[model samples]
Target: MTHGLHYTVNCSILLTDLPLLERPAAARSAGFDAVEFWWPFPEAVPSDAEVEGFVKAIEDAGVRLTGLNLAAGDMPAGDRGLVSWPGREKELRDNVDVVVEIGKRLGCRTFNALYGNRIDGVAPERQDEIAVANLAHAAHAVGTFGGQIVVEPVSGIEAYPLKTAADAVAVLDRVGADNVRLLADFYHLAVNGDDVPAVIAAHTGRVGHVQIADAPGRGAPGTGDLPLADWLGAIEAAGYAGLVGLEYKAAADPFAWLRG
Candidate 1:
């Protein structure tokens, strides 16, 4: 049922019914040995105590942190990322050290860098220029710790770009960094109208990580029409040997599919 791929629970999206600090242990109790997360703090840089508590939670749970997102902007306020935004370059840069340090402590080597939404005042070309430069900077910094960066194409946000595997891969090519790779999320790709199998077949070499959730509802696997099993098989057959993150919203028990 696992399709021969390793699985990592995404604590940021899944297991949300519990407090942030408790979810790592909760994931462990649910039989997961590895987990990933979006930025767990409200801002790009958090207090030292906040950082310590976040690190302690993961350490005490004894689960390996497999992936993390650099500080994207205010997600709840509708900001998608800071990498392409003009004025927040320093914030993004400052957050890199925090992310790298956390990764170094928790054995996480993969990081997700979200592409920011388009602003009315900024030219699209200018944003692209900034995204390339910023991504390169982050890549070089994380490379010091043997960490790699991943860029994802998200759905549901019209302003946010990078909606296809090609879009993300194009940016990676522009950055021209070996450590930068595409994050193939089945849910986002399918929701954005990209051919999932075609993407895997064509871009497996550039894929650094993979995430999954059902389409139409963005729920657990069986709740939607995506042929998740078939696509996962294709991903494995295509030779992507990495953890597949379970990033989905749960209608009830998120792990019910695991029991099935």
Candidate 2:
């Protein structure tokens, strides 16, 4: 059975409910062999029994975990980010430990890290400095669990700080950790008015993850003008063999429509 691409999960796309025990089953039914998610444990993690069950379900389904999104605790109390968050650095570090533990349990090897918002009155250079320091700590913690940290660059309109792949690379360079890598999402590239293949080419060595959806509307790959097949080919040519995550919402059942 050929599952088109290396099927993986992005929690929000397949399972919105937290402490997801059934997600593994759902993913299996959908022909997925790997799963990923935002944060299953928000404020507090799921119980040991619950996690055991979830892990068992995944094992039963024969699916591996590709990555886990470590950017979930970044809201009011959590302060929502890894670096450039002045007062909440401690909380961020603590959260990283928790995320890393989850990854270890799931046998996952990658974590999607967000650098955080840009302060209204702060200079860009200062924000970069903060991101470098904060992400350095995060990468260290992730490494202890034998996991890799992927720095995702949000669009300037979506996030105040670190809004481009180039920006993310600069921060990663500053962090100077081999564990820190890059995460490229097509939507973010479209939002930021970027050329996907061009960015991929420029940063091939640092990229560890790739996500895709249609432009304008984040529907499945074929729904918009994303040129997904071509882009996938480009990334492949660039030497990325990691999962190309399909992180989008379908208007209907994802499998309902087919070319033949």
Best by lDDT: 1
Pairs that collide, model 2: 11-37, 74-80, 75-80
Which runs in model 1 stand beyond 4 Å of their true positions? none
Q: lDDT score, residue 77, model 2?
A: 51
Cα error of candidate 2 at position 87, Å: 1.2
Q: In angstroms, give how far residue 187 of model 2 lies from its true place.
A: 1.9
Q: Candidate 1 on 1-260: residue-level lDDT in tens?
A: 55899789999998888999899999999899999999999989999999999999999999999999999888998888999999898999999989988988898999999999999989999999999999999999989989999999999999998999999999999999999999999999999999999999899999999999998899999989999989999989899899999999996689998788
Candidate 2 C-alpha lDDT tens digits along 1-260: 12334647665674544347677667777777788776655453456775566568667867787887765454545344546766666666777776776678778888877777766777868777777777787778878868788888775344445567887788788889998998888787777877777897898789878887777777776677777777777777778787877687775466443332
- Deviation from truth (RMSD, Å), model 1: 0.8
For candidate 1, the per-residue lDDT at 205 reads: 93
> How many clashing residue pairs are found in candidate 1?
0
Best by TM-score: 1
